[model samples]
Target: MIWPFNRKTSTETGAEYYIRDAAIADAKTLVDFKHRIWRDMFGHLKDEAFFTQAEATTDEQVKFWQSRISRGDTVWMAEDLRDRLVGTLHATTKHSEHTAEFVAAHALGELHELRYFYLTAATAETTIGTELIRTAIGDQPAITWLMGHAPLVETNLRQAGFEPLGEPIDPSDAPWKGIPRQAMVRQ
Candidate 1:
């Protein structure tokens, strides 16, 4: 569904942008955006072999996003006035089993995961990201979790009422292994 409060002006360009529910056609664009943002953020920290592996997963990413959108997860996209997809956000009740355990252990009721929330560098300073996150959260008082890597995202989440859940963990088993990531919760 299109969010009613999504319209905003970019601070950098003063161009209008809107956030709305993503469609199946957005899968490819989302994947491309994901690649761009991922590389921009982590490229210098990773090896060519890692990037090659990421390149090989394009189809998988497309399918994964498509399935999420089709399954009625809260997937929203921010588009410029020209209708170019510039950013995306996704939230869902579905999370890793370990995440569920974490929720239960903390007594966070029916938590939802902020699975993906990203903006292209050009649009990163706009209010669009905040609005998208608010749209996903709505009136739900339950806990929500987000893994924060970048300082901007962490600051935004904190400003939006999330707090660090615990110490940062080293993602030793994943790509960008050894990179410290913090788990945050909105409660």
Candidate 2:
């Protein structure tokens, strides 16, 4: 469902981007958004090999998103006037295999997970992310991981009553590990 730009939603007003449900065809665009987020997050390091490795997983990433969207996960996306995807909030009552491992590791039970929340730099500081978060998860108790680099996300999570879950850890798996992320849970 595409949200009309001029229409005001319960959570936000004057938003430059419209929030909508993502379709299966959006899998590639979601993958591209992931790449853009990674670029903004790590490009300044100028790590060519890391980016090359990330590129190697593009098809796999696209497929993963396709599966998620098809299965009714990660359903929310924010788009601009031109219909370009600017942001998304991946929240679900179910967990992915790796995320289930994370929940097990953290001893979290009976909680939804906000796996990935990304917005282009332009929208990063706007209310769009907050609106998406509220719309997707509401006051439901849930868990989320935020990279240390995204102060805006951290702030938004904090505003939504999410507190630090544990010590910071690098979320990346082997072969590419440099980020220090914090886990938070709304309790």
Candidate 3:
């Protein structure tokens, strides 16, 4: 059963888990989740000091989330039965095709950018990832283009009908750091 796209609580799990468009009030949670997940997952890629120095917080992430959500973008969360948010996935509609260096040059102009979706380590397999992606791209079934950072879990997405495109791209401008991201398109 699909929950309301604007609410975050779920009835069956009593976990308050739901995928809905994020709001300004969700900023702190979003930021905390991002930081926590990063420390938990990407700690080996770079120094934990960077994240600390970056001073990234839920309020900041929320501000960005609020801006995007306010502009037709959506962010989904996986909360516990106790209403504690555990993970998040952020997706936005791109007006223009996003060109990634790894994409076949010929296919660049033909794709739509279903950008940015992530799940917390603890909430990774709770079906939150699949649910969030479905919420974002389900209705527009024909627009079969999406991408994200998850080489380790590519198979899960593949099973869901998303095929890996090419190598992943760096989500930031920092030249010293890079993450292994995987891209997918509908087959």
Query: What overall lDDT goes with each candidate model?
Result: 0.71, 0.76, 0.55
> Model 1, stretches more than 4 Å misplaced?
1-15, 139-149
What digit string (tens of lDDT, one per residue) describes model 1 on residues 43-92? Answer: 66777787789879999998998897888765888888667877777777
Full-model lDDT, candidate 2: 0.76
Scored by lDDT, model 1 comes in at 0.71
Q: Give the local distance difference test score of model 3.
A: 0.55
- For model 3, residues 35-142, the per-residue Cα lDDT tens digits are 666665566776767777655454565678778767766667666656666656554434333344434463544344454445555564566666666776663321
The reply for model 2, stretches above 4 Å from the true place, is: 1-13, 44-46, 96-108, 171-173
Clashing pairs in 3: 14-81, 15-80, 15-81, 27-58, 27-62, 31-58
Backbone clashes in each candidate structure, one number apiece?
0, 0, 6
Name the lDDT value of residue 84 in candidate 2.
76
lDDT of 2 at 119: 72
Ranking of models by lDDT: 2, 1, 3
TM-score of 3: 0.68
**Superposed model 3: Cα runs more than 4 Å off:** 1-16, 56-60, 95-112, 139-155, 168-176
Highest-scoring model, lDDT: 2
